[model samples]
Target: MAPARPVVPADLLAAVLRRDAAGPLVTHYDDRTGERVELSAATLANWVAKTANLLQDEFDVGPGSRVAVALPVHWQTAAVLLGVWSCGAAVVDTPAEDDGGLDDVDVVLAEQDRVAAVEELGVEELLGLSLHPLGAGMTGYAGAARDFALEVRVHGDHFVPYGPVDPAGPGLLLAGLELSLGGLVDVAGELADRLGVRAGDRVLVDARAAEEAGPVAWLLAPLAAGASLVVCRHPASDQLKRRAEAEGVTATLGLGLDGIRELGRPAPS
Candidate 1:
C-alpha cells in the first residue's frame, strides 16, 4: 500500500464549518473555571478568523512560522489552535511547564505561568492568556505581547484563508510528559468512519485525550464526520459516563480500557 496521507487537523474543523455553517460544533466544558462555552459553525469561524489576524498582524506567523502554545485544555486553547492553523503556520505545543527547551518556536502564547516558562525559553513573541483585561508592559518586553482575548477582539469577524495548505500539512505540536504524549492527528475521511462518528453526534472527550491525541479521534474525527465534539476539562470517570449518557454521545473516542470499563458497566435502568 502507498504511504498514508497526512491529516491536517484544522482542515477537519474548517470542513465542518463549511459543510454546515449553521449547525452546532464545539461545546467547551471547564471544571477548573466552571465555564461552558458553546459554538456554532459561524461562531467557530469568527473566532478562527480573529485569532488568525492576531497571529498574522501581531506575531508575524505565516508559512513555516512556528508558534508555541502553552495553555491548558479549554475553549480558549481550541480557538488559539484553530487560529494558528488558519495562519498557515505550525504549532509547537509545550505543557504548562518548562520540560527543558522549546524547539525554535517564533511566538509563544501561554498562560501566566507558562509565559514565565516560555520567557526562560527565549521565544521572540509572547502573548499572555488573560481571560480579562491585562495591564502594563503589554507590548514592551523586548518582544511583541498581547492578551489573547483582547487580541481576538481587535480583529474583524471575517477571515481570509492563507497560503496553500494540503491535507498533509503539519497542524499541531503537543506536550509530552508523564502519561502525556502529544502529536498531531490528521483529519481524513477514513478515520472518521472507523470511529463510528456521524453528523450531529455530540462527542464527549477527556482533556488529556485532546492534548495527547491532537485533534484526530477527539476533535477532527468527529467534525470530519459532520458531528459536534464536546470537550470536557476534567475527565473524571463517573462524570464522563454521566455526560455521555446525558449528552447523548453517539460515539466516544480516545479513552483507554479503564475509561471503557467505567463507561460500559451497566447503569441502573
Candidate 2:
C-alpha cells in the first residue's frame, strides 16, 4: 500500500524524516552576516522536538494555543513553525511592529533585538532568539524574556505530544488568513504542484520572496513535494548565479537566473 497522505505540517516533516533523515532539508545563507547553516531532516526534527517540548512544558502550549512569531525568514523560524504545528498550536505570523491582534496569544517568540518592541505589547510569556550562526544564547540581553537558545537545549531531543493532534485544529494564521492543520497540508500539496516543485529538486529562494510567499510556499510546499530548500537572506544580486550553481539548485523562486527554472514562469520550449 502507498504511504498515507500527511494531515498536518508535522506529518509532512515526519514523511521527510522517514524518506531521507540524513539528507539536507534546509540550507540557509545570510550574505550580510556571511553565515551558512545546513540542517538535515533528522537535525531539523531534533530542533523541532526541543522547541515543542519547551512550548508544551514551559508555556503550556497545545491545541488552541496561539504563538506569535516575530522573526524573519531563517532556518530557526522554520524549526519554530514546525514545533508549533507539532503541538497542534496555531502560528500567528505577524510583524513585530504590528501588535493589533496579539493581545491573546499564549506565547510570543521574537528575535532578541525585537524583544523590547514586543514587550510593549504586554505579552506575559516571551522567548527571544539570538539567531546566532552557532545557536548560541543571546549576548548582552538583560531583558525579562527567556533565552530560547539556552532553554531549548535542556529539553528532550525527542517529543511526544501530550494529547492527540486534531487535524481540524487551528494551525496557521497570517495576514487575515487562517488554516486548520489539515488544511495547511492540503494547500501545501496544491501549491507544490502549482509551483512545479519536483521531487528531489533543490530549490533556491531569496528571503524577500520567501517572506512574501509565507511558510506555505517557501517551507511546506518544497517539503510536501519531496524537495530540499536553499534559502538565501540578503542575497547579493551579482552573486546569485554563482551561489545557485554552487548549491546545485535545480530551480528558483522570485529570482531571475539565466538557466534556472524559476517557479511561476512558463517552461522554455
In order, what lDDT does every prediction score? 0.63, 0.93
- Model 2 scores a C-alpha lDDT of 0.93
lDDT of 2 by residue, 40-146 (tens): 99999999999999999999999999999988899999999999999999999976457667797999999988888888878779999999988999999887999
On lDDT, the leading prediction is 2
- Candidate 2, residue 121: Cα displacement in angstroms equals 1.4
For candidate 2, the per-residue lDDT at 122 reads 85
Q: Which regions in candidate 1 have their CA more than 4 angstroms from the true location?
A: 1-11, 97-99, 131-145, 166-169, 173-190, 235-242, 255-269
Report the alpha-carbon TM-score of model 2 versus the true structure.
Answer: 0.98
Each candidate's TM vs. the true structure? 0.75, 0.98
